[model samples]
Target: GAGVSQSPSNKVTEKGKDVELRCDPISGHTALYWYRQSLGQGLEFLIYFQGNSAPDKSGLPSDRFSAERTGGSVSTLTIQRTQQEDSAVYLCASSLGPGVVYGYTFGSGTRLTVV
Candidate 1:
């Protein structure tokens, strides 16, 4: 893809349902990140994957949240048992490498709503 691409720009799911969000990062990008932004809140880092290294899941809010990057390219974020509080915009960004020196390209984001 020419740039990062995310599927399902907006998703509305019933409470307790599970959801999967997909992200296709730019070619050659080694670092991909997942973030959540609640209404009026700053971006909250969820997970990060760099090359072949283990993903940094420290930022994930709970066990219900998990993400994985396949072949160091596409990434998927799965949320189990969605809750109303989980309603937010899920953003995905990719960079050439670690750190912000190379800057990052972000997607429009997937808006997840649990009702």
Candidate 2:
């Protein structure tokens, strides 16, 4: 079983541009999550998907940030309009289920830098 992996690991864009971050989660895992972590702010859950359904979208900062899970495995996060305020580590994680009691693994993250 492979671990969750993220692409680019770093992204630099200008204000109002768009960016996409990719994630490949471990095989057989049914739950996936996206989070944002700023310099001082710790990990903040962005969205969570169980199987093919996203039950929570409360953490998404704005319309600019969105994500989707495919076939209950791979996932991609898209930022419609990148802003300096959107600069942060976009982290991806996967687990066996939805609850956070345990069993989640995180990717190194795609660091988005809006310049």
Candidate 3:
């Protein structure tokens, strides 16, 4: 019944620091995705998890970024050595499947600011 939830609607960190963003997906949904949107840019898919396995991690930007999903429901995205360019909104979404046949429900997102 729940949608997706992300913590720290806004995060401001000094450069070279580390931050962790959390996501809680709806119950029974087997698919969870992480995406980031930079100013005036399209949503970039960072990683995806189906159940307890992650099938895609191609868009993580750099080795400084990583993520993990546990119990097939909750996910956490961590960014290490933050840079000013890393400032963006990290969004999380879950779907019935890849297509979301109906529509995709997105979290309000955690806005990160690396100063």
Candidate 4:
């Protein structure tokens, strides 16, 4: 794709359910990131994948949240045992590399609501 693309723009899931969010980044991008923004809060980093290197999972809020980038182009973020506090807009961004120089192209985001 020419730009970052995310599926299921809006998701409504019940408590304890699991949700999978997908992201397709621009071609040739080497870095993909997942973040989430809660109501009235700043974007919180979730996970990062760069090339074939091991992903930096330090930012994941909990074990229930995980992500992976495959073949360096597509990525998926999975949230398990969803909770009300997990409601937020999950954003995916991709860059040519892992620094400020390359900048980033972000997807519209998937709004997750837990009830």
Maximum-TM-score candidate: 1
lDDT of prediction 3:
0.90
lDDT of 2 by residue, 45-108 (tens): 8998998789998999898888888898889899987889999998999998867577789888
Q: Once all C-alphas are superposed, what RMSD does model 1 give against the true structure? A: 1.1
Q: Candidate 4: where are CA atoms >4 Å away?
A: 52-54
TM-scores of the candidates in the order shown: 0.95, 0.93, 0.94, 0.94
Candidate 1, poorest ten consecutive residues by summed lDDT: 51-60
Please give, for residues 1-115, the per-residue lDDT of candidate 1 as tens digits.
8999998899999999999999999999999999999999999998889974545889999999988888989899999999999999999999999886978899999999999
**Candidate 3, pairs of clashing residues:** none
RMSD in angstroms between candidate 2 and the native structure over all alpha carbons: 1.3
Error of 2 at 24 (Å): 0.7
Residue 19 local lDDT, model 3: 99
lDDT, each prediction: 0.92, 0.89, 0.90, 0.90
Model 3 lowest lDDT segment of ten? 96-105
- Give me candidate 3's TM-score against the actual structure: 0.94
